[model samples]
Target: MSITIDPVATAGLVSREVRDGSRDGTPTKIAVARRTYDAEQSDLWQAVTSPERIPRWFMPVSGDLSVGGRYQLEGNAGGLVERCDAPESFAVTWEFGGGVSWVEVSLTPADGGTTLELLHESPVDPDFWTQYGPGAVGVGWDLGLLGLGLHLATGATMDPKESEAWALSPEGVEFARHASAGWADAAIADGDDADAARAAGERTLAFYTTPAPTPEA
Candidate 1:
């Protein structure tokens, strides 16, 4: 099934920020994305933190979920919970492969719903940042936010197979383009060269929308 996504609406719903800092003397960059969901802070918190609910929108999670405890995402990253403040915010160590990063999620109440903010901080690897820009991580979170929105609105689990198909569909391509551009803008706002940021954005767009390479004959 083809999913019709509104690129403009999606773009409007998310706000991105890139912040530069240092971690243990290594340069680091934090990519932050915020969006409002049409649900109460409590409900949104449960949707994100509950292991049972996570697989519905994101991926299956296992392990201790409390503060100072470790958690793992099946076939994905695992981490230690650094902080947790119930229906409000949490921070974790996002360990993947041999690299480690940090992720924090915050929730704030709004007029009709809750504002969710995700912050991912990692040591800045020049090569990767130069090639993919913030969309490397930003776009992934953008898609997660999309899934969260759907779950909050419909209370139905999305078919993973269908969601994969949708990502390569025309609408998905457009959405990626918009999201990539948004990340580029955020990078530029964070003092990146505009030309380089736009170029990286194009690469990121291609990465997200392009089909995998076929085997050589």
Candidate 2:
């Protein structure tokens, strides 16, 4: 299930790379991305951390986001804000059932906009990786990143169901297709074979476009 995407084909609105020890202090590895938007830092930061702005772009997130404060995302899981440095960086305890991971989001001011960097790390589980591959995490991030972009540019949020459905649209498919290829290239840049990565990207796209099975035909 290891799918990869070609970042260059994505036109640099988003790009991915594998990095070392940011979430968990280990060398096992993590995937990272840097996305830049036209909005200023203040606007972007508020959109991400403000309750009023949460549901508009992303999900309804509730948490102090201050160090040591527990937070929950409405129907989603809850976790403590492991670290928080206003407008700059924050880390959260990514908990689900008995499993635990960490995710850190950081923002830095650039020439005209801000660079939003995200890092998520899970315990390198072979079984999980085998079933979902990189998209298991990458696809989720892609959604989150899109939320941020939509908020920055349009100052609006998308309906959850609509968003998911949109991901099946032609434009959405193209985005994912290019994104998957980009990730494949990233893995290849990290020493994997280019051809194999390309093939994985194709399989991943097929899975995304495939219709789910229903009961009673």
Candidate 3:
């Protein structure tokens, strides 16, 4: 499907933040992203929580999907649902690559629509943070938010293959670069060195915008 969007404008719609905290006695870094969608609270809530609808914007997910139940996103993280409050908020453990993180999502009425806040908190990895900062996870969520917005506006289920292609397109590259810069600013606001954060953002921009190597014929 062809999509028309203002890459920088859409990237600006999200409010980003980086936070430092502790979880289970381990230092943690939090990436927070907020955006208001042009949908009613109930509709936005359904778009996010309903299994039948998730794949439309995100990815295929399976397994039990309730408090204490386990769920997995296709080719991505799987974890246990820790809490749920219908049409309002949910918290889940994000288990990936043998590391555990926490994700919380909350919805609120705002600007005649709904505002969604996504917070991803994970134990700090010095090596990873030095290389990518918050943009590592933040850019991915930014793309997810973009997909959800597009799905909400058009009521069309996104084609995963097409979505991947778009991410490599010029427009998508612009969006990724803009979003990476936003995350870098957020990191700097949270006490990261300005130059290092900017450098990390550059790396992140390249990471998301780089096309995969072609297979040898």
Candidate 4:
């Protein structure tokens, strides 16, 4: 099982789980985030759609913006757009490799801004859930959405710098800690052992919060 945590790149960002349940092919859920930008939808869409603007907010993205076109980020792998509707909704394969999952993004106009909704769906390893939890993926997406919002609003990019710093912040540490416990509960809900799931969650959080000792060797 692979476990990872990324840092937040923007301020005033919020994220929550919207969907988590069993499905026909894979068990998945939806996570949503809301951010208010001073700009309009047209500019927001460009930041999300245009390659030049992507690195400014999200990862470096390159691919055809049309439906069914393959896309890839420099170090983030590749996927094809399953669907696309200009300035509103778009779907893309969320697969990292080896038949993983797909994540879709839908944009809805809101009060003076836009609401970005993300749906990540695919098969999950029962063992993976028992060890880490949904936050491994969910939290990363949370950070991604935060980056996108900040980019559209301020025309900036925060990658390794913000990611690294966030991993150590008090609030960031607390977030990981609570998120770990929550995901462990979710794993148990999926039929994992209560004790084992909790242990795994605690262990994951410990690993994340633990820092390297000073250079003494």
State TM-scores per candidate: 0.95, 0.82, 0.98, 0.71
Worst 10 residues of 3 by lDDT: 1-10
Clashes of each: 0, 11, 0, 1
User: What is the TM-score of candidate 3?
Assistant: 0.98
The lDDT per prediction is 0.91, 0.71, 0.95, 0.64
Model 1 root mean square deviation, Cα atoms: 1.7
Query: What digit string (tens of lDDT, one per residue) describes model 1 on residues 1-217?
Result: 2345586687669999999988899999999999999999999999999989999999889999998899999888999999999989999999998999999999999999999999999999999999999999899888889888888888988778788778888777888888999999999999999999999999999998888888999
Which candidate leads the pack in TM-score?
3
lDDT of 4 by residue, 1-217 (tens): 1113343333234444434656575666543434555567788778777878777656777778678788888777678888888888788886575665777776678787776666776566667655665556655665566566555645656676666566677767776666566556655675667898788878777767677677987
Query: What lDDT score is found at residue 167 in candidate 1?
Result: 81
For model 2 the TM-score comes to 0.82
Better of 1 and 3 by TM-score: 3
The C-alpha stretches of model 4 lying farther than 4 A from their native spots are: 1-13, 18-39, 159-162, 169-217
Q: Candidate 1 versus the native: TM-score?
A: 0.95
Q: What ranges in model 2 sit over 4 Å off?
A: 1-11, 20-27, 75-77, 130-132, 206-208, 211-217
Model 2 residue 112 CA deviation in Å:
1.5
Q: What pairs collide in candidate 1?
A: none
